[model samples]
Target chain A: MTVTMGKALTAALRDAMREDDTVLMFGEDVGPLGGVFRVTDGLAAEFGEDRCFDTPLAESGIVGLAVGMAMNGFRPVVEMQFDAFAYPAFEQIASHVAKMRNRTRGAVGLPMVIRVPYAGGIGGVEHHSDSSEAYYAHTPGLKVVTPSTVADAYSLLREAIADPDPVVFMEPKKLYWAKDEVSLPVRTEPFGRAVVRVPGSDATLLAYGPAVPVALEAASAAAAEGLSLEVVDLRTLVPFDDATVAASVRKTGRCVVVAEASGFAGVSAEIVARVQERCFHSLAAPVLRVAGWDVPFPPPVLEKYQLPGVDRVLDAVDRLQFDDAPDPRFLAVSP
Target chain B: MTTQAEHRMPAVLPGGVPPADALLPSAEPVRFLDDDGGPAPGDAHGRYERPSTELLRRAYDAMVLGRRFDAQATALTKQGRLAVYPSSRGQEAGEIGAVLALRETDWLFPTYRDTMALIARGIDPVEALTLLRGSWHCGYDPMATRTAPQCTPLATHAPHAVGVAYAARRRGEDTVALVLIGDGGTSEGDFHEALNFAAVFHVPVVFLVQNNGFAISVPVSRQTAAPSLAHKGVGYGVRGERVDGNDPLAMLAVLTDAVESARAGGGPVLVEAHTYRVEPHTNADDDGRYRDHDEVAAWKRRDPIARLEAHLRSAGELTDDDVAAAGAAAEAFAADVRKRLSEEPVGDPAELFAHVFATPTPQLREQAAWLAEELAR
Candidate 1:
């Protein structure tokens, strides 16, 4: 069935709730208003306010409450109205929910999901457009999942909901309206698996969430120049699919990881490290990373430049193209 | 806002003789069950019952077990098995009494100091130790046991309890969420938020504030200008009550009523379990710097466990043999727990990287790899 990423997520949640009475969804504006992004639209009406409802304007309260509910045999899915709004809730995520399972000696499991609408393309204010996945990914006991396509949005979300641990589900706000033809009967995929979008032998472009489209566009641009560029969409950030990323890097002999998070300590850093470890000898050049600037996500006017775009991916490819040809520049930098 | 000076009225001392409305807001403490094991009528709220032999026996058992667990955990910390331990020695009845009154399915969100409550809620004693050992983020499975992880930050877990109760009420589940916080926690924003939310939603939660009078170095007098912690609940529009935390029967009666009210969907209730912490906040804190010895001595006279023991003996529920056996069992249990904790292996540092995510992010993998290499060198 064809559906937008938002529609697919909503449908997936609807299906999950239908299948499991234990599943519940709550957040600000999620009940009567269907969430700010309408991701939870019609859910409260269908599931009844008991299963899906609005909460107070407190993010930490939302996540903390969900932790308690999950402890009580309920699978709670909490939504932070926007990425920026999730900061207040970070304390609960880090201090309590994330560590509950291990702290409780594996006796307590937090079967909860925190859905965050992240990234910029919609002229959102600073707080609305930021990508803070790195913060959560850095945290222990949280499973971070971000889907690029509708199929992934449907499948991975279902998997996240079913997982016995807490999951931080990041939905790219930019791609909310982006449509794709998704097959009916959504299949659940294991967390930390990457999907190969386009296959090529020259170089590999690894990206996830909204950046997948940019990587694909870069691959197309590279193809026109007689450059075979492979595109990889990382469906999950935590428990990352290192084997797939390493294999792609080994096959292409060069790779660039693209993400909307800042370059410093971002998800791309992990991709680079894995490629270096598994595909070190096969590399034609050092693995490149195309990411947002270290600064906070820029305002709408400058966000285009601040975020990693197709041009940045191509630039990374341009730098990697000279790996086989040793030049004066390499020797000059050796000293 | 009232100035701090204006609120510095000396705490009205409880008279040597029990008052008519001691537990009520206007009175000091209504001692239905006195320290001398004599029966007295409760405040206008209700009359006191001469508890049955079985109930008194159970109360004694709970206190002994709570004390044993607290002692074991303290020993574990001293032996370097746990990172830190907060002794719940003198505060046993304040926690155990309320916890024992809870229904099996009722939720509990306890603070770091409420180790006894966790023990009462069926968490493996060793697992609770594991949390203090800092080997895991949560020491127990909250989902399976209806108890949340020990909240280190003060009062943060209170709102969670309220929220859970709210959710339970929405789902038509007759479950009550009980949250334990310290006097210090009442100063935090989350505390006020939780109370306000509970009042607004009429969530079926019981906010049990164990007012041990000191939050780390700060005394209760410095924490707020309100006459009492129970009065703070009035601002939230919830029914508030103060019980002599040292009186186990009083705590049980109040907590039972609160739990039942929550279960019946009546609304939230705030209970200020007035007690004192005989020991320092934790092994790391020093009470000498902040508190007076005279104050400690005064509170010791009202020891909850000792009073309950006196009551049980007077009621003929507890025999000398029963008391001796309970003491021996508690001591043996504590020794066994200490031995097992000493034998438990120290967790691998790399395990820190595990469980953050179901799948490690590439970046975390890289950092973990880097740490592994660095450690190898």
Candidate 2:
């Protein structure tokens, strides 16, 4: 049966809460209101208010209380409501949630997941739409994971909740309605492993979360133009799958990283640096980044110009600076 | 149509507690002892029972030792043995009283200046001083000691205590979490948030705000215009009370009442102990620049240790031999601490890679290997 990403995430929460009585789901408007996005719809009714409850509209308090709850043996799964709204809780996430286990020398490990509806596409106004993954991915102790597909949305969230350390689960707000044919209890490969969605030898597109679909669209567009591009969806960003990423880069010999967050000093920048350092000797050109402009997110109507699209990915693909290789697939297409 | 009673909104706080206004702190700070260590003029504090004679004796011993440890820690900073030490010299009565109010199963979430409380809780002095010694973030196992690491970020630990207490109650455990906050911490957003969450959830937790009159150099006057830090609790529906911090009798009685009420499922309580930070914020700080010496001298006259000793001796609960014994034991503890701290700490570079996560990431493993190779040369 077909399932939307939003439904898959709700199913994941339900299954986790059922599988382990210790798993709790809580956040603002998550209970009776079922969340503004309705991602937690029917959860409180099914799981009861004790298992899934609503909290006051205080972001820091929600996360800070989760930290305490995690330390006391509850596998707390909290929601940040929106991307930029999570800034108030950033101190708690970075200082306490991320450092508890390390600072305590393994005496305390917070088995918690902070679900943030992130990235842009759905014409969300200021503070509602943002790609704040960089803030969490940069924190060492946090496991930053984002899902671009329905199956991944379920599997990754379940695994994240089951993991001992805290995880920042960035649920792409745009992909919440993206539907796919998948059954329940769908277990994907464990975290820290990247998947090669589309195979090609010309160049590779490394993306995660919301950028995965754009990369795939760009790959399809490239294929239609007689150029083959490989798409590698990075499931987890922190324990970055060096083997999978480098192996793909070694095969393709060119790379373009796509992300919705601004490029400068962001996750895209880190990816480009890591790829070039690991695959420098096998490169056809410097790894390019196709990302949002290095500025605050523009108004909803103008966001399209700021967000990376197929054209932008193809533009970077044409700049690979590949040599005059014998195979037409390896040649950089002219604009 | 639904009936009016059915449509009425639920209470902001849980049931079984007194009305919100009744939970407000008294107009004047509550005191059981006068400045001279005798009973107060009226019986305003009579409602709260004084601690038992045995408990009072134990509190006296702990305070004497805690103050000695606090002084020794400060001296260690001057001698280059510690990175820094925030002295709790004059607040021993409240610190010791807070520790004594908790059972072994209860948790104590302390701030950086609560090293004396940690010592009073029977934590090894060296282990409790590890953060100040530049050895580690925290030296002891938090689970074993039921004490969280001394938090440096003010008021941040308040929510954790609430969370722990909430979880404990859910598991049918009678565990209460007592969080220690400074007067300045009451101004932090987390402080208010924690109180609101605790009251809403009806968690078993106690917030003991030691109104030490200073957050570093700024006075409490600059922090908040609230009637009192304890009074700040009423806005969140948590019962707020005040105590004379220097009077060990009052501190013990108030904290005990608050802790027991919460443990009995009466929900969280906030106790504001009016005290003073007699020493500088830290050994490195110059208190003279912030306040006059006369102010410090005036507070010194109300020293918690002297008042407690006088109260205990007059009641005949403590003899001269007991006072001398307490002093001698504290001296020995300080001497042992000095001797042990003279030795430099040995650090293992490998430990840097440990405990960041339950399982170190592949990237961390690679970085650890690189460091190992670099150190091999």
**Predicted model with the maximum DockQ:** 2
What lDDT is obtained when candidate 1 is compared to the true structure? 0.80
TM-score for chain B considered on its own, for each of the candidates: 0.88, 0.95
lDDT of 2 by residue, A1-335 (tens): 99999999999999999899999999999988889999889988987788788887788899989998999899999999999999989889999999998888889999999999998999999888899999999987999999999999999999999999999999999999999999997999788999999999999999999999999999999999999999999989977999999999999999999999999899999999999989999898878888999888888999999889999899888888765434344356752
Every candidate's TM-score, chain A alone: 0.95, 0.96
The alpha-carbon deviation from the true structure for residue A168 of candidate 2, after best TM-score superposition, in angstroms, is: 0.5
lDDT of 2 by residue, B264-310 (tens): 87788999999999999998898888899999998899988888888
Model 2 stretches astray by more than 4 angstroms: A323-335, B1-18
lDDT of each: 0.80, 0.90
> What docking grade does candidate 1 earn?
acceptable
